[model samples]
Target: MILISLIFMNVFAITVSLLIIVADKVMSNYGSCKIIINDDKEFEVNGGTSLLRVLFERKYFIPSACGGKGTCGYCKLKVTDGGGPALPTEKLILSPREMSSGMRMACQLKVKNDLKIEIPSEYLEIQEYIGEISVSESVTSDINRIRIRLTDPKTIKYKPGQYVQIKVVTDEGTDFRAYSMASNPNRTDEIELNVKRIPDGIGSTYIHSLKVGDPIEFSGPYGDFYLQKTHRKIVCVAGGVGLAPLKSIVQYWKDNERHRRIELYYGARTIKDLYDHEFFEELARENENFLYIPGLSDPDEKWTGETGFIHQILERKMTEGENSEAYLCGPPIMIDAVMGVLDKGSISDDRIWFDKF
Candidate 1:
């Protein structure tokens, strides 16, 4: 009887211990908090969560291309008060200029007490979308220009030239990558995305392997690189797989019959990488306001198109201070070169928007 009592007591103790551990997390309350933004707006929120998650719940969107994984430093908020310490993960992403300005990665800074953080007013305009993969189709050479039909409670409202983060599930776990929405705005039921097969990119590998019926997870309508509401002339530049967002921008123009005189310079190493040219040319023929210039940087003998570096042609075509907005999407190197050329030509920084892959 004494042995039986001892066993019961031990079992009871273990169960209590487990319960306490679980309760500490689920019922762990951090009490009240304050988030002061730009020293103007003060939001009282529950503390003890990362600033990223809290701000999102509060409807203040911070751009995080990596989905709060601390990998992409897009979600930097100025934490002027009550954020604990500068975490090692945050240290990895911060630049000297960002650190000096008290900017910290929102995913890294936990709200130990009250906190003050700075964010762009534009962030307030961003929204979180729980999107499903309605269709994932390959358009060209292992590259997929997938059309993700938004399911669930359905309906997604977004501007052309914006992007979303797809949660890629792998054997290890899940990771995130940003892709531009290539769908036209006329249809809100489904949006489109173009994905390049990165050699070992966790997301792209999984994407390449996914079929039509697989349920996928995604979020956002992020980035500031959209067409400005203006009558100014435009230049759209893109590289290999960077045509995704620019395609969205053009789709918007076509739907609205936007009459801004536009020139698109799409560059690829060869004809194989170039995509959707026929469709774009169709638009050019229909709308005299638009023109298409597809260039093959390193052309084969059989290639019978514009065969020169794209920037050189751009230098000759675009007028300086023409009140033109230039949208670029491509690799970092291409973007920097174009930025330099645009700067030399007196294009204001405000007139430029891009998503560098």
Candidate 2:
């Protein structure tokens, strides 16, 4: 009698577990979903999943530097119809234009119903890569210059001046942070990123603590802030860690035999803050069309070379009608000031692009 009771109880438990699993799969599958994107392209996708993941699988990628965790706010799409309400996770980031235009957070919205959405055309080229750490070198004081090798989905084919999102975890929770690609597209297997230590920021804190062998997951090849196809001279200005994408662009131009005159302006608080200067100086020598300029904002007593702020040096040198494409990345204050000076030099607003961090 005791043996029979134990046997019956075990069977019941197994049956319950199977039933629960079946129910979960059924609830998660919402059937085939029809996506009408930009009201022009239609996609039929398996349903009951977040729009972010679905779009990527279907080849109409919307940029989400955070890999659909609902943190970075880069993966936004217009949900004209069939979007069922909104999720709490997305409320903090949606702007007024986004909230009113039938737009919804792609990561938050599941394919419960037939949907119509819109995304920028440039984002169509971005591809997610599952990359393994190839190298993690201490390039500067408290800064780690990492190289990742692409494995599954094995290549990040992107234009110069684009960025990828690296995943980060901390004692508190999981989140994602954006970092620009510092390596060129020519070097397909390995991707390079520059991570600076942030005092209390979650993502940087976690990355700073990581060692050489640690594996980190990331996605991208995102952003429209790339070099325009033009014969005009190029001026790239960067401060602190903003040099990542700009460096990629520079390397690309040099590798492709681009003969257009290019000037790079890098700013540092002191000599100690400047990184990889000798390498860039060598690049400048190899490519006669390129010039490297390093400026110090507030140098120590031992400092020399170009003093004062970066923008001041830039303003003193720039002449009108240079017919230049200006790319600036730095703190907000520096970006705004550069914009003002560029405007004064008669440079078109379209010619000026900046990355503010």
TM-score against truth, every candidate: 0.79, 0.77
List model 2 lDDT by residue over 37-99, tens digit each.
777889788888888878766766676665577776777788888886667777788877778
Candidate 2 RMSD computed on C-alpha atoms after optimal superposition onto the true structure: 7.4
Q: Which run of 10 residues does model 1 get worst, by summed lDDT?
A: 125-134
- Per residue, candidate 1 scores C-alpha lDDT tens digits across 69-131 of 788788887777766567888788888787877888888887767777778776776665555
Q: Judged by lDDT, which candidate is best?
A: 2
lDDT of each: 0.79, 0.80
- Point to the candidate with the largest TM-score: 1
Candidate 1 Cα lDDT to native: 0.79
The alpha-carbon RMSD values of the candidates against the true structure, listed in the order shown, are: 6.6, 7.4
